[model samples]
Each structure stands twice: as C-alpha cells, then as structure tokens.
Target: MSRSPSIPDRPHRDIDSDLPDDERLEALRGHYEDLVDVNDQLSEQLDDAEDRRERLREKVDRVERENETLKSSSLYIATVEDVLDDQVIVKQHGNNQEVLTDVSSRIGDRIEPGDRVAVNDSFAIQTILNTETDARAQSMEITAKPAVTYADIGGIDEQVREVREAVEQPLAEPELFDEVGIDPPSGVLLYGPPGTGKTMLAKAVANETDATFIKMAGSELVRKFIGEGSRLVRDLFEMARERQPAIIFIDEIDAIASRRTESKTSGDAEVQRTMMQLLSEMDGFEARGEVRIIAATNRFDMLDRAILRPGRFDRLIEVPEPDRDGREQILQIHTRTMNVADGVDFADLADDTDGYSGAEIESLATEAGMFAIRNDRNEVSHQDFTEALEKIEKDDSSDVISSAGYFYQ
Candidate 1:
C-alpha cells in the first residue's frame, strides 16, 4: 500500500513578554492573523483531498463492477416454452436446447410462456426480457397524423366515401353496423393509374380518423431471407392488433400479391409464402377485431385472384383519372393559395389538361406558378399556364419516344 504524504505543521509565532504593552499587543495581533491564514490553507487542502477521495472511490466502484462481470457466467437468450408450479421450461435460442429451470419467487408470478428470457449455462432464469418486435414494423407506424384532409384531396369523392365507409365509419359508429345486423367491410383495395391520388386518399383517411395509421409498401415486405418476410408480416399484424382501431395502408401491393407462377425459384417461392401470410392475416379464421386494411396498387391486373376475393377486399374500388370537372376542382384546390390573375380561368385550364389525372393537374398548377416566378411576376396569368402545359406535353412526348427506342433496341 502506498503511504499518504504527511501534512505540513501549521505556522506559529511567539510574542516576547519584555516589550512595551502597545508593542506586545501589536505582536499578539500579528500572531492571531497568521493563525487564521494557516487555518484557511488547511481547510482548502482538506476540500481538495475530499474531492480526490470521491474520484478515487468512483474509480474503485467501476473496477469492482467490471471484476464481478468478468467472474459471472455468460447468459444466453431463451424463450419460455412452458411454466409449471415453480419450474419453467425454456428453449435456448442458438442451440435449440430445452431445459426445465427453477424460477425465483420474485419473478415466478411474472414468468409466462412465449416470453423471451436470459438463462445461464445451468439453464437458470436470470431475468425476463421484453417481447421483440421487428424494428422495420416499428418504423412503419405513423406517429404524427398527416396534415391531409378530405378538403385537400380533389376528384376522388366517390373513392373517399367508399374508403370512409369501409375503414372510418366502422370505427367511429360501430353501433350502426351492429344494429343493421351486417358485418362491415374488412378491407378496401384502391386500384388506379400512378399519380391519380390513390395515396392521398389513404392519407386523408389517416388524417380524418383518430386510429393508429401504419403505412408500408409491398416491396418492403419482400425480405431476402427465407421465412424473414413471413415473420415480418406476422409481426406487423400482431402490432396492429395490439394498437386497435388501426388502419394498415399497404401501397403498391402488387409487388408481393402478384399471381403465382409455376416457377420454382427460391426468391419467387419466398414471396409467395409472404403473400400467403398476408392473406391469412387479412381474413383469417380469427377475427381481425377493430383493425382495418387498405391497400393500393397501380398494377391491379398483376394481383392474385385469391387476394381479390370477397372476404379479403370487400370493396374493389377503381380510382380512375379525373374528368373535366374533377380536373377543374383539382386545379382550384392546388392553386387555392397561389396568386392568380383575374384572367386565369381554371375551367379553361381544365379543358386544356384533357386526360390529365388529379396528380397531373396539381403538377400543372405548380409548373404554372414556377413559370410566373420565372417572369418575375407575383400573379400567375393564363399565358403562364399555357406555357407550362406546352412544356409538360413536350416532356411527356420525349419520354414516350425514349421508352419506345429502348424497347425497339
């Protein structure tokens, strides 16, 4: 052991008694001042020593913890298979070894089957672990509701009504369905061309309802490994069940629900398995409770016939391109906040945008605003819209030509 350094003695001063009374008094005052200075120095040293002692104590405690950890046996992850009186059967994860372990009284009441736990080499339960949810599934949950509402969406009134009836009405007014002695729609499938407000409709539903919104794409469900995709699908549905009155929006669902083929490739087989799991979850033997499913697909023809059956998707709604009226409505909605000149007529703009979808109409409005900005104008004129229309047509034609060339080559 290292010896601590000794503290130096306090300073001392002796006053001579032979001096005159005033001189003696002055000398005594000086001696008293010196003692006070020494006392202050000692107190400062003691304070510094205490600080050092605290730091050393903390260091020692950390080392002790490390030493204890090193001496402890490694704990392996396990799943509780069954729980008996005071013993529980656990299956070790990596080795698939099942063993009966005694549970302490502290955690005996809490130990249950299907729970994850940590076990030692002797199969003694150390601690119970939380049920693991797929991180990918957790990320798919929409914590913040979208700002979109029914008013924000244009040209999809009928589709919106159907979605609300299928998803929203059941959650909001279940008594009506019960009184009518009819089961509400389990799922709604929206099929339409790309950029026709299919996704926006889902957003509107999410915003309108106070239920949990979990949005995911079909391509994301197709994992690279065997069983991984199916596991993720099961986990997602389980999570939705936990958060009741939840709406699951699966976009571009054709990626996994495509028609099955005779091909025996592993990749294709895995996808088929995942789709089967999704089908089971959609309209399984067990009730889906308060959960509702909404899926959208651009390639509706590619979807499997089994998935489109009555029970899975009670309503197969087609969200087609907006008509002249819808186009005009969409234009007005998109440009509601823009600075439009008095001469700019949305009806004329709608007529010009002939076969455009709602999304295209919105894009046209944005492009017109950009054109006005380019000309250093605050208000958008009819001429700006005309120019924007021409530019979009030209770009579309160029894209068509490029695609044709690529196919021909």
Candidate 2:
C-alpha cells in the first residue's frame, strides 16, 4: 500500500517580458538545485561501484594465488637420515627411497639428523616439516585428573596394588628400580570379563599419579586407509615421549593386538600393520624414557603373542568377579553415602548376590536407592535391595536364554 511517486515538475522558463523578474530568477535557481541533487546521487553511486570493484579485485587475486599453488609441483616429505660434511642423506616417507642432496646454505646449519623436511622434485630441501603427531592423539592427553580413586574401587585390592606397582610407582620413583639393580617392569595388562573394574583401576591410577595420562581405545587405531593407523600409533608414542612422566592406557586392546591372521584382505592387513607399529613403539631399538603403559582387554586370548612378551607387558593382572566377601565390601562402599535403614546388613545382601561383579553390585545399590525413592521413602530398606537383585537376576537369565536360542537356531 505504498503511494505512487509523484512525477517531478518539468522546468519551465520563458523569456517573455511580462513575467516578473524575481519569478524568473527563482525558476533558474530551482533548475540549478535539481542538477546539484542529481550530481550528488551520481557521486554516491560511483563510490559504491569503486568499492565493489576493489573487493572483486582482492577476491580475484586470492583465487589466482591458490591456483598457482595447485599448479605448482608437489613436494614430498623426507627425513634426514645422516648429516655428512656438505650434503645430507634424505629418505622419502612413503617409498623409503634414500638420496644424497646438497642442502641450501641457509638451511644447512639448521638441518640435523632425524629432522623431517620437505623435498622438491629435484631432491632439493625446501622447508622443514614438524614431526607430526596425530591431532586426535594429542587431544587424548589428559591434564585434569579423573574423580576415581583406589579407595572408591572395591573387590580388586590385589589388582590395584599390582597396577600401582607396575605403572604408578615406576613413574613416580624410577630411582627405586635403578637402586635395586633391576630394570623396571615395562607395562601391565588387565584382563577380565565385562564390568570387572579394569577400566576403573586405570582411572584410579590416573587420579593418584602426577604423570600425564593418555587414554585411547584399540579400535581407534584401526583406520580406513593404508599406513594411517600405523602413523597414528607412532604419533601417540611420540607425544608420550615428548611429555615424559607419561602413562598410556589402551582400553579394549584386542581390536589391534589380536592374533595375526593369514587372510590378505586390505582391512585386515591394515590392522596387522598398525599392530606391528604399536609393537615397535612398545619395544623398539630405542629405549622408552619415562613412559608407562597400561592396557585392558576382555579377550586376552585373542591378543598376539608378540605384544604380550615379557619386555612389552611385564605383568598380566586378571580382574575377576567379586567373591562373597568382596561383594559385601563393594556393597558397603557403594551404600556409604546413601540413606539406608538401620537394619540393612551388607553381609546378608552379599550372600544373596553370587557371581556379581563390583560394578553390578554398585548398580544394585543404586537401584535399591531408586526403589526407595519410588516408594516415597527417605531411607532404603532390605526389601528394596531384594527387589533390585531379583530384577537383575531375571534380566541376566533372559539374556542367557536368548543367546542360547540364537546359537541353536
């Protein structure tokens, strides 16, 4: 509902002597004013056009530079193998081809053995590349401690001790091993069924120790492309070495460390290659300075023998299901902060829950509290624990029956 713009009145001037002199002067002045307004508008439009042209010029320049880069000869990554008098031995990354190249005087003094550098088609050193660690691996280094502590865990006191001795103590007091005239244990491997507190133990170690804790899963090392997985492993270890007093925890380690197979599929081959790289990083020619290793797996039997040798994994700790006494201790630990009735007995509850892991016992305690909450009670009673246990037992039986049915079918 905008109104139509009125047409501008056409300028009129007559030279008749009958017309008033002041009116004629005013008419001329109006025409002059109209021209001035149009000139101002044109000037504004010219300024805008010039600005647009400048922006387009800049955009074109950037694109042209990018095009030049794309059309240029691609450079290859090479490592300095040796530093001779005038020339250096450079080895290409992918094909491992070695060549002797004369370094530019500008870069000759700076170049050294084991430095990564870029090479042109003529094998001339162009620029130095950083020893690249995978960005994902770099992000996995934990600076903040986990809330878990050894006191919070239950039913695996011996396993906790062994882990502390193998990982935490060595990193904290390396002089102990040296003074005793014994090479420190290299690493510890924790194996058990699900919900047996293997991962929690690692978390406890991270919480108690001052070392840089890096945690990763074995499945993360399996990559979609060739050599990518292996590269990631190398970068992870390099990151650990760079940050000494470091602890590396690999969870579900069977994904990469599984037994090497004869099958020649590309995917399987890549996994094995990644595993070999991990093995080399763990027990290569060079010594690991102050890094400690902790790994957890449910299927210990599937891991390759090379990875489980004495130098690689010095201690193999098994975290089993909680026994009767352990169940009581775990139950007590979980329920300490909860509001429970005075008549509740942890020993009686533990006797009822046979073959339950520490995690399951914790869950039972939580479920009992939830039941009391549901019933509008302030404190949990024995009946709540009984109901929770029955529910969990039913679920377990149902799972077993379904699994058996599937196998038969």
Candidate 3:
C-alpha cells in the first residue's frame, strides 16, 4: 500500500516544479528573437524622430539669429530710386527678403540697400552740417529779418525816412558806402515810448533787406552760467557770417546796455558781461556791411554811454508820438475798409485825440467800428466814436482827450 501511494503522487506532471533545461532553452531563444525585432524597429523610429527635431531646432535658431541681427543694427537700410533737388526718395528693406517699407533717408547722406539707417545720424560727404541750427534756437534771439514790407507798415514817414537811410538803403546798396568812402554804420537804435510803431519800422527794414533776421531781447543775452552768453554771441555772429547779409534786431536794448553799476552782485555781473559781449559784437572791428544791427529801447537814458558811442550805434532815431496829421493818416489807413458814416470826419477825430501814438489811433478806430457792430448798426456813428473815446479813456485815461484840450495842446 505504501509503494502504490508514492507512485500515485508522481503520476501527473509536476506542474509546480521548474521546467527541464532543454525546454527552458527553447523558450528563451524565442523571447530573444522577439526582443531583437522590437529593438530594431524602435531604433529606426528614434533616428527618424531625432533627425526631424534637429532640423526644426536649426530652423528656429536661424530665425532667431536673423531677428537679433535686425534688432541690433542702428542703421536704417533703404533703396534710392530717385534724387530730387532738395529731397531724396527711399524705401525700407525688411522681412525675409527685400520688401518695400515706409522708412526714408535724407539726401547727402549714406545708407545701404535694404539696410536701416538713422535719418538724423548718418554720414554725408557734404555733411559739413550747419551748426547754425543750435545757435538759431536761442529763445531770446531777435532777427532783424521781418516779413513786413515797407508798404505793409503805414503812417511813420519821418521814422521810415530815417530807417531807410540808416538800414534799408545801406543794405540795398553796399557799394554806396564804399563809393562814398564812408564806413557803414555798425548799428541803429530806435527809441520811443511804447506802441509807437518802432517794432513795425524795424520789420519794414528787415523785409526790405535781403538779410537773415536774428531777433532777440537784451535781457535774454544774460545767463546764470558763465561763458554761455559769450559763446552764444560768438555763435550768432558766426551764423551771420555763414549766412551773409544778416540783421540782428535786439528788442529792449536797455536790458543789455543798462548803465553799468559798481555793485558786485551775481546778477549785476552777469548783466555787465552780457553787455560787454553785445558791445564787442556790435562795434567789433570785423563787423562789415554783411552784418547790421538794429536795437529798440523805450528807455534810452537807461543805456550805458559806451553803448551810445558812434561806432556802436551810429544813429539813434526817435520814434515820437504821432501828431494830428499823422494820427489822421493812421486812422485812415486802419479804417479804410470799415463802413464809416457819412458825417464821420477823420480830421475831427484827429483833432479830438491828441498825444495818441499810431497804434492807439488804430486801436481807437478798431474799437469804434466794433462798438458800432455790437450795437447792430451798419455804420460807425459820431456817438459810437464818442463812446469809443470814453471807453478807451475809462480803460486808459491818459490816452483820451477833450476836443478843446487836444486843440489847445
């Protein structure tokens, strides 16, 4: 019975036990074959994918490098197709290739085809660039050059005659001075009470002369910083030289030409320095017919005696208040276009308003016409004129006058 039990236990295959060596070897060989096939396919797929990724990366890097190059360049590239007298036409180059863009470059400057260049920053063979731009930008610069013609300004016959002889004639005929063996006057000073057409007279001279007008105030020439004012003066003269036939009009000459004080305050010293520079510039030996100066001042007595010297201001013209005849003419000039009433007498008006400057007369006429318009009247009446006089008197009592008082004066 014991022997039979042992045999029964061994009957079926021992499923829980390790396989035989031959069978184990065969199974392992089949698994190795499958692994090789899978490895080969995976390696091929990996090579293809890596090659595609590398190509994409190279493309992206190239794009980035190009973008960086474009961003870093300070130059603006453009194509030059046409060159006009004063203007040059150009197009910007951009994109992956040459493409038309809105960028432009100035003439007499250099730029590359399809290259970016700064319009303001570039090389010009003719680049002896004008340095006058900076000097001309001074805030207080007053140019003698004016836009008003002699015809444009009205009612200053005596003043105009003086200006013509002093400024306009000299500018128009440089040879006249040479022929007469007389050196041209260095400057002319216009002095008058405020609002007497002094400025207008200067404008007429500027318009008459073919000169560059450099207008400035005397006070503007003084600066807190040392040497700055002097440098500005030198630059201004240099500009006048480069651009010949220049007129320098200084408004309020008393500011720079004030009577020198013995005090040593910083402001006083600055003003003195500015005045010295102005005097030197005005009467400097190098001043020729190419440059002329005109200065205006309401306070002529406030100016230093040295500034009034012959060489500095060869002539000092007085622009006085307009007399009755002058006022009548001035009023007529300003009111020629207005719808005047039949009884409006300019002579009566002139007789009524005395000691009024040309400007005041014009203002009075304008005010009278405006009053008429505001009252819904087509014509300026004697009542309107009287009211205008009263209103002006109320505004500035000193300017208005009674008819009897005016005639008596």
Candidate 4:
C-alpha cells in the first residue's frame, strides 16, 4: 500500500538518487569546519591557563627568597609586636615556634616580622627578645675625634710646619705633588727631651687634618698573648687604610721600637715580630691613599735602625728644649689668664732658663702664679717666681738652679 501511494505522486518526472553528490559534499565540509573551530578555541584556553600557572610560580619564588632571607637574619620574627631599644619581637601565628633578637634591623637588613616569613624553612622567625650588652656594644662603636689641637698646645712651630707639609698637604693636595714635580717626604719623626711637646705636635696634626685619629701607646702593642700584638698591628694598618685621611699617633714608641738587642727569649722574639709587622705596614707597598703616622719618643737613638731607613721614618726632626724666644712665647701663652706684675719681663725670665723645655716653662709659670695666689697677692711678681723656683729645686735635684740667680745650662 505504501509503495502505491508514492507512485501516485511521482507524475512529474526525472528521479534523483538517494545519495546526492552535492548535498553530501556540502554537509561533510560544514562538519569539518565546525571541528577546526572547536580545536582553535581549546588551544586558546590552554595557553591562558599555562600563563596563569607561570605567574603563580613566580610569586611563590619571590616569597621563598624573602622567607629564606628572613630565616637567616638573627633579627627575624614571626609576628611583629613592637620595637624596643633596637630590638624586634614577633609572635608566631597558628604555631608554637617563637623567635627573639636584640640585633638592629632596617628595611634592607633582611629581617621579617610576620607569618609571611614561614615560606623559608632554613631561617625561621621564632621570637623577640633584648640583649642589653649587644645594644650597648653597637652604640659604643662611635669613633671619637681627637681632643688635642694646635691652639690647645703651647709651642713647637717647626714641628707643626713639618707635619702640615709632609702629612696634611699630601692628603689635601695630591695634585700639587705632580704639579710641583716633587715627591713628598716619606715620613717625619718627633724626637725631643721629655715633656717638650712632641706628643702634642702629633695630636695637633690629627686635629688640623680633621682626620680619624687612632692613638695607641707602644706598650699596648706589645701584648703578652702570642701573635696577638702582631695581629693588632696588621688590623691597625688595615683600619687606617679603610678610614682614609686618618692619623695614627703612637706615643712612647721607644718602648716597642728600642734598639734591637740580640734575641734573648721568646718574648723578645715576639716583640721583634710585632716590630717587623709594623715595619712591613709602614713600607709594604705603593703610596696609600690618605693615612699618616706620627710617632713620638724622648729617645730617638733608642729606636731600631731599620725604622730610620729611607722611605720609612725618613725625616728626623728634633723637638728640642725651648730657647729664649720659645720660652718667652710659651710663658706668655701659659700666663694669658694670670694676673702678673707689669715689670715681670718674660724676656728676662726666658734668659734665665737655658735648658728648660716648653713643658718646663709652663710648669714654672703655673708654680709662680700658684705661689702668688697662695700668699693672697693680686699679682705674680719676679720675687714670687724666685721663691717658687727654690721650692721646686729643693723638691727635685733636676731643678737645681734658682730662677734668677743661676741659669740652667
């Protein structure tokens, strides 16, 4: 029945095959285009996911580095609570771990004070605490300036000039050396009678240059501990090199630098070792940037011969006892604040002092004034100086001459 019904409607004509070539071709092309579009969209989505993963990984890496830095720093903390006297404290969050420290920290100092520090296991932020001694140690590292100055000292003009030229000028005007075509003198030595202003001259150099001044007695460098003294010598030179335009003032250098006797014991050998270290430091290499050494001694002859060699302690200057003019100047300077008789001629007083050093003159002037004050006199007179001189002569035989009657020879 169904076939008959279809035949009744087929009156109009040319029959086509059930599978038409054009229609099938069109359908297959459309299906292939849709698959290609789907693949492209999937590729785009995968690319975006990969980019997001990389970004996350970078953030994790940055956090890891910060956490590691915090763990390594002693001042790291888990929770930031407060800062007290250069100390930082942290309380751990959701964990029993604690950290504490008294060390100072700043922005770039690699410290972390929060739970964000947990990213690094190597360094952990545990707790916060204070070490008063450590705080004090950090505070005490300030370098103090040299206290003595040219104005504070009494005499020694030549010595000051030599230091200014050989040391101060060399540091301040390096171009001058090349311009003048003259190599600066290698070194300057201050040798004099006791209390003749040698040490004062060195201190004045430190003050004039406004340089970092490191002062050490010769005996301090002669440590009983083996190798310690030599090591300190090396450290001192290195520190001076680091702090350029620095002055190293060594007082009583004759104690460690005395004439080298034949070795007697290990102690002597150690002392020689220290001296050798100092020698090497003085002349080891090229012209250093801005470091000058000023050494003082009452006995120049007592220093080791090697120390006086060329290129090392090359200039030997005598800070001698004050002459008449020098004595007058020194007396005048010391008596600036004192009440003195108008007839008290410092010229006559200086003429009476032949072998006195500047220090001796100052002491004498002070003694005279003190005597006047003790007797309730308003002015220091020549007679008071004579009496004071007698009293000092009685006290020490070294002061055997009376002020006016006998001149020291």
Of candidates 3 and 2, the better by TM-score: 2
Ranking by lDDT: 1, 2, 3, 4
Structural similarity to truth (TM-score) of each candidate? 0.65, 0.65, 0.61, 0.59
Candidate 1: count of backbone clashes, pairs at least 3 residues apart or interchain: 0
Instruction: At residue 195, give the lDDT of candidate 3.
Output: 71
Q: lDDT tens string, model 1, 1-409?
A: 2345456577677778899999999988988888888788788778878888998999999999975874486777677889999999998754457898899988789988977777776787878866443334443656447677899888878888888887788778888888887877778889877777887887777777766777877777664223356656777787677876677788878878988878978778778887988888876723235777889887777888888787787688888778888888899999999999999988888888776777677878899999999999999999999999999998884354224222211
CA lDDT, every model vs. true structure:
0.77, 0.76, 0.66, 0.65
Alpha-carbon runs more than 4 Å astray in model 1: 1-141, 223-227, 285-288, 397-409
- Give me candidate 4's TM-score against the actual structure: 0.59
Error of 4 at 110 (Å): 19
Task: Indicate the worst ten consecutive residues by lDDT in candidate 3.
Answer: 1-10
Better of 1 and 4 by lDDT: 1
Better of 1 and 4 by TM-score: 1
Best-performing candidate as measured by lDDT = 1
Cα lDDT of model 4 overall?
0.65
- Looking at candidate 4, the ten consecutive residues that score lowest on lDDT are 1-10
> Which window of ten consecutive residues has the lowest lDDT sum in model 1?
400-409
| Distance from true location, Cα of 183 in model 4, Å | 3.8
